[model samples]
Target: MAPVASPTLLARLLLAVAFAAAGVAAWAEHRADLARRAEGAAFAKRYSIDVRRPSFVETAKAEATGDLAYMPLVDAAVQDAMGTVALANLEPSARKAWIESAQELTAELAAARGLSLSGLAARPGWAYHAELLAFLTYTGDRRTAPVDLTAKSARWELPARMATRLSPGDDATWGFLAGAYLETWPRLPERTTAQALPILQRAFEDPDFVRRGFGAAVAYLGVEPAARLLPKTPDALRTARDIVGKRDVPAAARLHAIWETVERETREKDLARLEELAERGDVPGRRRTAEYWLVKHPPGEFDDENGRREVGRLVEAWPEGSHGPWPRDPRAQLVQHLLAGRLASVRGTALARLGNQLTGVPDSVRARLLLAAGDRYGWERILLESGGVGSFDWTRFFTELAARELAAGDAEKAEEALSRIARPARTECDVLLVRRAVAREAGKTAEEREAEAGLALAVEDRFGAERFAGGRTVSPCVDPERWADAALLVKVASPGVSLVGYGWDGGRIGTTLVSGEATLAVPLSGLSGRRSFSIATLAGPEARASEGWVTTSTGVRGDQPEAAQAAPLPPPPAP
Candidate 1:
């Protein structure tokens, strides 16, 4: 493997400074420069709607810790470009071409960010003329040019509301290439976005670009990418209030993006990672910000858990004793939770409140959520909100999947039919989808759901005590004692040797295997009898202590066995 490039020393030292100084320095320096430039009658010279130097900005682009002498030159070039495009008297054909040229430069002006695009002239493929042709080809506009250009006003002049409608800028962000890819997005997705990206995102690691692209792709998909490329959108309006209630980016925006991706794909999309960064993440700045956003947003115990726990990190993060329900909260749970009491008592509060708040949410959308909830909670008039038969399960999202399998549509799902927990149950009793859907989601077949009660009973019998350790920072596995859900515990032991159940991925963190029967009986308690022991931490290979766990020893400790004197170390047995 090629050696990974490290971030520059200057970058590491000034990162935080860059973030802070970026604000005040920009304001002060720009203002001071504006004044000095104004003294030179810069407005008259720079504002020409006709200066046409496409190569001009190339000389002005900023170099790290470099002077800004080139900024004015670039600005003048842009003014000229915009002016060239603004010519109202130009023929429709020419104007159309100019509009095409103008769009590229104008896209960033409203965001008022990023360095000049002058360097594109250096590479013919990326050259301004080449890009303009591509844009025309991409958008399929046939209009020609004699175009008069104008100021950079139209892009940013939209009402804040309309501006919000713009899909996020991928190019201007930490994920520039990703954004660039989207900037040229064909209104309809083709084999390119779908097929090309998975390969590219895996090999690319320019941090600011690749990681961001990977994240944005995941965001658009509404699912977790490798369980690391997304962030938890805090549902607590108050928790997210600082961002939504206060700042521009809602804490939930990240999570919502992930959830939406998952909901839409509803398939377990897999990726082969060519590099690992989220773990030993070398990216920072806006890239770091994007990475942080990704890290904080995956759902809880959410394996369609046993039930997905109601995530409230944002709520939890909100300082205690804060006031008001942050109404605009992006979190579904937060919005639902805050509206809890306002609902009627008859139907379960979720449906009732949701029914009352139907306008805020869509009717079809409400139906889907309510119907799914009803699958577990039973029907009610509260669920019968006005003109609809809620869509929570419409298009047969869950059952249709099962129906397809029974209908013999998808063999992979049929082959992989196994009952794992669906979603974490909030309130220890939130509606759970016991049946239906995908090779990855729950993988239940008609047979599984038909046998849901029986299979679930068996599942409950075998692994009901299987709730694993839960938390954002906790390992994917957990301790033996922590395993409580029936789906988790199993029983077996030796004369005194019986074992209970075992945890799934959620359980079994920190556990190590020691010498035991060919089919190791999960010890109901610790390994019993004078058996050999093998052990290791959750992250590595299970080790063998010279001595095994017993009355005086920790199975893991190599030191003198503690009060739990463990059995002797297991000999390296036959492979």
Candidate 2:
């Protein structure tokens, strides 16, 4: 319009402008691509991703270029890296960023294959790696979050499900699955075992499986099953012995299995087996089993009037000093004494053998044995002497002695014993019971009422409606300052009996006793819901004692009948 030009020139000018505009647009796109490449490289370096190889970032670029063949390689490498990564070493913020980046990349790769994350996860082989990535992310998040049993179950579900899909020869996957099942067994026995048993049974039958670290899982499956699965080889026996020796196996089952093995080996006259059992300070179970055998078959005589001396002959057949493992086992020695002390003829010898080394015996056992032997002097010596004794043990010993003294019409001696107990905010129920009795004998009605109020408060603290059902039960004993966290609800079949819950607290055994079917709560410190503990019921002198108590590893729920069995309490010595 500015100049009247020829038609050809006008057409050439229009073409030139169009070419310039195309050049500018191309340059801008090139710059943008370079920027994206830089970003991808930075991300790869930050997360320790190998850019030289096909990674998630590389796979994305290849996908953009319409190359789908590299998808599987990239996916596998990414998953391998993710699984081996030390996410715990990363800062929290950095960890969050890395997890987010991984999630986005996984989504992109999954989309490239015409599938969603769920579809990819369900797919077998390399495609299943995406689910593992997702699981890794979940575990990472859990590192920073509070995890309970439910959350743990959720975390395990993915791997456990993945494990089921893997081929039978995949020992690595199976081992991991078994470990997870073992960890949650106490909390979710049925759910874990149901899914795990069939697959594990198959694996256990395969000898190749034990070449890896599958022995422990087999043991956890059960001693009988493991024994059946494994062939009778020295290596198999050693593996079984090692696995059965672990504390993870139930003590009763472990002891039984070990005893069976020992019996079999003894019948075969395997000196190596005996030496292995006598090997000091390795597996405590082996030593314990040997000690048990010694106790059952003492070196001297059988309980027979015919005096067959069969066990003594067996001991003589054993290499000199090989049968002396029981001497190293103090608890077994005390048990042997307790059994020997039951008879009047050997009672003095047993008492002398017990000699001042009463460390391994519980106060209850000591009381029972000494009272049965009518060794009042020995019983009083243990009660009065407090060296190397824990507070809980001291309190228990004094409480029992005080009760016997009070029952024997010695109020002053009972008072002296009661005074020795240090009154903490919480104590064994037996302490309060004895305190109330001592106060009554001393004719102090107010003191007796105070002790009774304390006991009532303890009962209410654990089992009251205010704690359980949000309904207040006002009583003179209610004290807000002394409330403890509710842990377990314990109920006995009979009323008016004392129950004691025992657990390890800071490497020392701590006990809480509540009388008359009250709830019991051990302090939370150094205690876990799955930790094994024993509850011992102590009734008044007339109650018949049960043979032994059962230890439970599970937490008690509302009104469960899993109360402690009563242990024998021998009658007080004659005055």
Candidate 3:
């Protein structure tokens, strides 16, 4: 050592050096703070974000320490994330972290602001904050997100409570409340409906709120309850109707409103109002109302004066030229003309209308209309084309057509028309009458005899010979006793023609073969009731020709006839 120094001098020299270093560190921190402030100001100006508040400074300090109690932080973060590209450039983990922090901050701010009504009213920006919070809560991962204000644990009444603080004349506040409530309604607990009604009622009382299109929150309460909440005035009813008719409303709610309105209008006997609603075909609710009205008051028979008036009323009220698969069950088109007792006046129009329809028109109704219009060709075409199907009553149509053709002297066409009859058993007498006349007119004596005998069997089968003995159409050619025995005489014009006779009960009985001009008896005792007979030629030039007939016996005869009874014959082999 060159010179020993005193302890006080050495200590003073070290303290000076330490003080200098401390000053330099303090200066560096001050410059960093200044730079941060300047950068924040520039960001606020460039993005038009309002950060010129004490809360922003507090938010920065809290963010560093992981605290979230300020509202301005949420606003700034949302503005930055939504308005700038910086968020998109963030890495996935950083982006997630930023969003989570923002969500927690928003929840914290909403809960704090919602606790005091006076404070919420003093600051109108809280309304926007509540809206942002609702948006965030509803749009976030809803199951685990912290922002469900509607939850029982959360401040569920924040929006409604804020709405209550709004002055009666403050339309803007009312609109905000309604909009926020509407947005959050889907996630709201069902238990909240009672709580929400009062707030909604207050908001709707402001005309400007309704004018701003925020009055639609009524649907959240559902139809019946919502209807009870509305004013009973005509304007209010109309407004309710319009609101419910919007497509965004639930269909069940809309239908309920429509039906309730209809019931009220009908109960009050407000026909004009009801008709007005019915005519608005564009509104599905009103269209359903019109359909209900049509169904309840159907057009009765035209013979009654009251019924005719109803027809006229319905025709006038029909929503024509509108979107309709019209309820045509009442046959309104047909009855409308029949109301005036002027069938001729509507014949052409009826044909045109009926022609346009591919289905749904009854065949009998169309045919009668065609016949009335002297469109015989149309009637005949329908019968021929339908081929005894649908609602045409084809048996009757073919029978009538045949009789008409016979009277018109077109015997060939008459016979051809008769061939198309599906159930000849139903119209057997009518068919035989036509056939006998056709045969007599053609000078076929043998055919006329055969038809006369067939007619005799039919008459006896229907009305027993004892029931109408004198009025009988023809005498029985086959003895009544032989008929009971299921026996008949085969009298072919040519001899040695082979005949195969068949009987039917529930099923086909054994067949019997015999030569022509001989007595043929079938063992039909097993049959309980009347038996049917058919003869087919198995040999000779008339091979495979068949003729069917029914026996007039009401009971089976056990006694066998001592005639040339034929044994059961096997059918000819297939070719």
Candidate 3 structure, TM-score to reference? 0.26
lDDT of 3 at 46: 34
- Cα lDDT, model 2, residue 404: 79
Give the Å error, residue 555, model 3: 46
Residue lDDT tens for model 2, 135-195: 4434343344435434556554664456446544665455545545554555565765677
The number of the candidate with the highest TM-score is: 2
Tell me each candidate's TM-score.
Answer: 0.22, 0.28, 0.26
The TM-score-based order of candidates, best leading, equals 2, 3, 1
Residue 112, model 1, lDDT: 18
- 1 or 2, which is superior by lDDT? 2
Q: Give every collision pair in model 3.
A: none
What lDDT score goes with residue 295 in model 1?
38
lDDT of 3 by residue, 347-430 (tens): 444433433332455565556456545678888677667644533265544555666777888888877766766644433555
Which candidate's lDDT is highest? Answer: 3
For model 2, the run of ten residues with the poorest summed lDDT? 541-550
- The local distance difference test score of each candidate is 0.30, 0.45, 0.45
| Residue 284 shift from truth in candidate 2, angstroms | 20
